[model samples]
Target: MILKTFGWSFVITAVGLALAVLYDGWTAFGIVAILSILEISLSFDNAVVNAGILKKMNAFWQKIFLTIGVLIAVFGMRLVFPVVIVAISAKIGPIEAVNLALNEKEHYKELVTDAHASIAAFGGMFLLMIFLDFIFEDRDIQWLRWIERPLAKLGKVDMLSVAIALGVLLVSSMTFATHAHLHGGAHADKGETVLISGIAGLITYMIVGGLSGYFEDKLEEEEEAELEAEEAAKKSGKGGASAVLLAGKAAFFMFLYLEVLDASFSFDGVIGAFAITNDIVLMALGLGIGAMYVRSLTVYLVRQGTLDDYVYLEHGAHYAIGALAVILLVTIQYEINEVITGLVGVVLIAWSFWSSVRRNKRIAAEGGGDFSEKAEVSTGV
Candidate 1:
């Protein structure tokens, strides 16, 4: 399974590097290599989150995620998305944007960097909600009992996650807005820009998340009806509820969920890439390498049943995500070092992996089967 999952990723990396060398020689290749590593370091937590959602999807959809979805990740995002953003932001045509990217890379990079505040706000808020929901929900296992226990109780408040997020956004916007005016930088009204951008982020979260939850509820109702019918048939010794995931809005929403999630995660990588190199092609090739590996890792986690085996892994990933979200928000005004960003996530996930290993030993010693099965039952795996 590991080979089958990562084999193509290695091939993609080889091809990307070869193309990089041919296009702009070894200098470009080096930049691509750095960008790829940067992307991987920043987004390992994203893979874990993707795995948790991917396991719920049917095999066909999963294939789409790995194949069709990858094109979107590599080209649509790494290549085209930046062009679109630049074209719109600079009030130029797509042709002009492409020229800008190729002929005047520094100016193009500046435009992209200038857009960072809004990008950070949108991505940060979406991810913040994901973390908040996980932390606030009632769970069978509590990794950090003292903290999570209280947060779960606080979850009972209606729209608690959204409320808390808004409050945080409010505080951040005010503090930064005040700071921007006092600092007297290039942006004259950055405070207002930050505020509006943040509200846009909240609205986006509401629409996408609401649609996802609504369809999921409908899917659950249909499943319950099928289960009831299955129970009746079982009384007469017949087969059980259907396990197949058909093509429909529910599946479509799941796809949307993943795509948007990926786009949000891409914001930091895109902006950070400017810091490394201003060449768009090099940035794309490098980030593409990291993206392919992340997709492969997502499939690996799902097929290997890693989530089930490492019970606290998802918790750790989400916690890391929560931290990343806050860091992105903070970066709106300050220039944070990428090294610090990567290390925090690595530490949290490593800690969780260690905890899960210890947990498995305890469960085995107590004469229980793999805790993965129990985690599945609790998590609807």
Candidate 2:
């Protein structure tokens, strides 16, 4: 299994890098490798969050996630996305955009610099809402009737997230709107207003993300009830609905959620990567490599049952997400480098892994022995 997995990853990486090399040669290879590692490090939190959803998915969809999904992630989003953004903003065509990125590298840099604030604002607000929902919303399984009753009745659903996003949009818009005019300068040109794009992105995020969450919760509840029923039926020696179908449906949404989560995480990395290299091919290669690592890490979490073993891993990732969101928001006024953002996530994930290992060892010790001892006992040692 290990060899097969590594072999597949090798093939994909080689193919991706080969494509990069075709476009830009040896320099492209280096850029992709570095960017890939950077993206992976920055997105460890993304992997953890994805594992939470991916673990619940059926095997087939999970394969799609690792396979087709990676293409969409690395090429579609990481590579093509920035080019598209540049093209739209610069009022140039796609072919010209690509040519500009390759030959007129400095111009590409200027384009990314100009768009940075708006990207930060949109991505920041989207991630902030995600963080707030996770932290403030009730996720506990209500097993007891008494507790569920009053809790459900009195639980005030917080709209503070929406309000906060709106506030950010308003402030970003007003600030950009007045920035040039107040300086007795020329009127801000179209597609140059950070405020408008920021507000639009934030509003779109709220609408799409909110609706997704609502449906996700509903599906999750249905799945939970179905699982319980199946378990009960099994206890009574009866058959149950195909677990795979239910799992597939559950996984589909989880996949969607994971993609959205990835997009959120990639926001900063995407913007920061432009700061390093404006070669579209190089940017794609580097960021694609990073995305591959994240996919591999997500699978590792599931196969290793890290979440089951380490209770706090998910919590730590969410905390990191919250911190990233805040950092993105701060970057609107203060520039925080992508390297710093990437390092912060790496440190947090490393700590969580260490904590998980310790917890697993402690549990094994408390259980009176290791797996070898249990095996011996079962064999009548």
Model 2 accuracy (lDDT, Cα): 0.68
The local distance difference test score of model 1 is: 0.83
lDDT of 2 at 220: 74
Pairs that clash in candidate 2: 32-286, 36-290
lDDT of 1 by residue, 253-335 (tens): 87778888888888788878888888889999999999999999999999999988888889999999899899888887777
Least accurate 10 contiguous residues by lDDT in model 2: 372-381
Per-residue lDDT value at 256 in model 1: 77
- Expressed as tens digits, the lDDT of each residue in 1-381 for candidate 2 is 565545666776788788878877887777877777778778989989888878766678778889888888987789777778788867889999888777888777777666556666667767777766565554332212243335344445557657766776566555543432211123342223555665666676666666556656666777788788889898998866555554555566567667766877888888778666777777777787778778877887788777776655675687688789778766655567777887787676667667556655755877744421221201010
Model 2 deviation from the true structure expressed as Cα RMSD, one decimal place? 7.5
Give the number of colliding residue pairs in candidate 1: 1
Question: How many backbone clashes does every candidate have?
Answer: 1, 2
Error of 2 at 85 (Å): 1.0
| Candidate of highest TM-score | 1
